[model samples]
Target: MKLLKSKWNFACLLVSVIWLASVNAVALDARKVEVRGLFKNAAILQVNGQQRMLKVGQTSPEGIKLIAADSKQAEIEIDGKRTVLSLSKKIAATFSEAALGEARIPAGRNGHYFTTGMINNQSVKLLVDTGASSIALNSIVAKQLGIDYLTSPRYVGVATASGTTRGYRVTLREVTVGGITLNNVIAVVTEGEFPRDILLGNTFLSELDMKVESGVLILQAKY
Candidate 1:
């Protein structure tokens, strides 16, 4: 009975040591993960300085799994902990925190700064327009985004290059540009598709600090 008891204690000690080593290994791997690029249903990751491209539902050799991805961000699972990563900025903490976010938009071929952003959880192309008083979109685009502007009680007139047209003022639930997000943003929906792209106007831009560097537009949330 004494010999059997000794064997049991040794086995328990060995198991505890192995479990501790496994936990340490996971922590080390988590520290090495860096998001390099983001795409629809895919992400480029750098683990321990080695780059790896992982599509949705794929896992890297280092045990990092890409859960979901889009131009804005990537969702990854490492060591059973899920985290969202972004290409625009490196955040030390999870996005659930009210930590400020920054985004860099490089100039396009037309010498205009454009980016893919989220409006009400849906992806949309955005054009930075400082002259616009409020976030503006065409009635067609608004309908595709499920915005019921026709029923909105706030009716207004919007001036277009052609002439003055009907418009509806509404509040957006959320608008996210890169890592910066704002809630309850006022916007205008014009009756016709004059502005080719969604105008990211002053209503959203006013809340952020904007600067131009090397033809790149950097938008950082003030709060």
Candidate 2:
């Protein structure tokens, strides 16, 4: 009788352990699913769905790759699944150009002319000038942009290399680059002869998140 009772007790214990393990496994799976959903949402926000066609395919090392069929959409591969994703047009257009290297800003060197990007739907080219105390513009550029330099307060000073220059304290109504824009930017208009057309100075550099890594100057607006 005792032997039979002991055997029954052992069987019940094993069953209980198995049931508890199954419950724990289900809980872990639920957590993983929730995390994946959150990540997808975040990616979607950064890049709109309309611009890209998302597809899945089997690949080496990893089981599958999620690719953007259209160049207008940024291509990303999802490993281990076959799926079709429809994204918003805005996201697709933004990524497609990026993937094609159309909108990429090439790495700039010191004393080189580089595009400052778009501002108020206008493309502005900036010359890298470390010596200028503030962002300086030539009379021609100021006039071309319809900036009334004569109306603003005048500041007379000598430039670092150019002798005896006259400047003005003018606020740029809008300055933009790389899809980023800044309002009321402080700038100086120097009358001195500049080797470059426009000078990108500390005034603009200070307002950006700048880093020089591996001989590349990466600048991003702080806003």
Candidate 3:
């Protein structure tokens, strides 16, 4: 009995250590990076938690080099690994490590953009809507996602396709797209037809760097 207990304790300790290491890896994705906002003849980049402004031929302290940048995407070389980073898309933490960073989605034939997204860990189909002020979800989708809008703060008016309507603004605990995850995102939930598809609005889109190319919409995160 004593021997069995000792072995069990050791196994538990090993599992805990592995779990912690995994968590640390996710939190400290040192190689993962995204483009923030941009400017003419230059780009603002978020790398390793530091903000950097680089021209077409600039490099960061952590060894991120801006090979080229346009309205569509920024090409960066990290640790000798080169990747085309779309605005708001996160690429590998360490360049040349693996094609592990960044998320890419081709546009549909409809000429509109769409991608799979996650809200509070629930899978959702998101339609990219640049004109939208913020991410909007209908009450039905909110309930399906297990969001409690009744408990949210006082409602506010939101301008929709139909007209102005009342909506509840709440901070989403977590939102994930193409493996890039952001937390504490403010979203609006209104009554009616919003359940068909979640709108990917600027509330989250503004935080990412975005560009269009060859019928593709790319989004990259700054960090």
Candidate 4:
């Protein structure tokens, strides 16, 4: 894989972004939050394991200040930059430089790319999807991770190839792929069955810069 910007460029800004293990990883990486659902003036965001209902111009406890919003999308300021986030799309401020550099994913037999990642600290397979809003997996995957979604109030109906389905919205404690580890990542649980590999959606991919060349998918941190 090739570096988009010079390696020296990353070297220059590396000192400012390491998380070094802390609950405050949410603070250090404020962009891990995802715009799950939106409404007029207010929005539902998942920051790590907590869901926040914030209004336009209101900042959450973790420093996510809503900039603008309507039924379709939202604009917010994080880490000193303004970003317009669409419903289900995740917009992050940045990622750790040390834990967020390059990766090369070779094409699979089916012509798609596959890679290994850790979800909520457990190993799993990931299929990169630039189109999905958040990380998506089946209920069976959630059960293996010890998540009980039935009692959780954040259930929603999803449209799938099989038809309309029920799923739960939950926050993942941590998701690490290659060298990057992100906290407060948002994901969906497709109640019973879903695709075999988890869909590594925008919630995680949006934090990086990626390119496809020679059947190899290259990913790099965009801080």
Compare the candidates by lDDT and give the number of the best one: 1
- For candidate 4, the TM-score is 0.53
RMSD of each: 13.9, 18.9, 13.0, 18.7
Query: For residues 26-77, what per-residue lDDT tens digits would candidate 1 score against the true structure?
Result: 7775657777555566555677876566668878777888899877778999
**Model 4 alpha-carbon drift over 4 Å, by segment:** 1-100
Q: Which residue pairs collide, candidate 4? A: 48-184
lDDT per residue, candidate 2, 94-211, as tens digits?
2222221112233445535354433233345676566777778876677767778788866656464656667777777766543335677778776534534677777766776665
Query: 1-223, model 4: which lDDT tens digit per residue?
Result: 2585667678666644453344477557855677654555655566775656565777877788888876567788886888887655232212111122554566778988776666765556689888889899998888888876677679788888788899888888888665466788888889767755799999988988888766767787786
Residues 98-156, candidate 3, lDDT per residue (tens digit)?
A: 11123344577887887665688655678888887888899888988999987987789
Using lDDT as the yardstick, the better of models 1 and 4 is 1
Q: Considering every candidate listed, which one attains the maximal TM-score?
A: 1
Query: Candidate 4, which ten residues in sequence have the lowest lDDT sum?
Result: 91-100
Local distance difference test values of all predictions, in order: 0.79, 0.49, 0.71, 0.71
Model 3 TM-score relative to the real fold? 0.53
Query: What is the C-alpha RMSD, rounded to one decimal, of candidate 3?
Result: 13.0
Which stretches in model 3 have alpha-carbon errors above 4 Å? Answer: 1-101, 161-163
Off by more than 4 A, model 2:
1-105, 108-113, 118-121, 160-162, 192-195
Q: Candidate 1 or 2, higher TM-score?
A: 1
Q: List the residue pairs that clash in candidate 1.
A: none
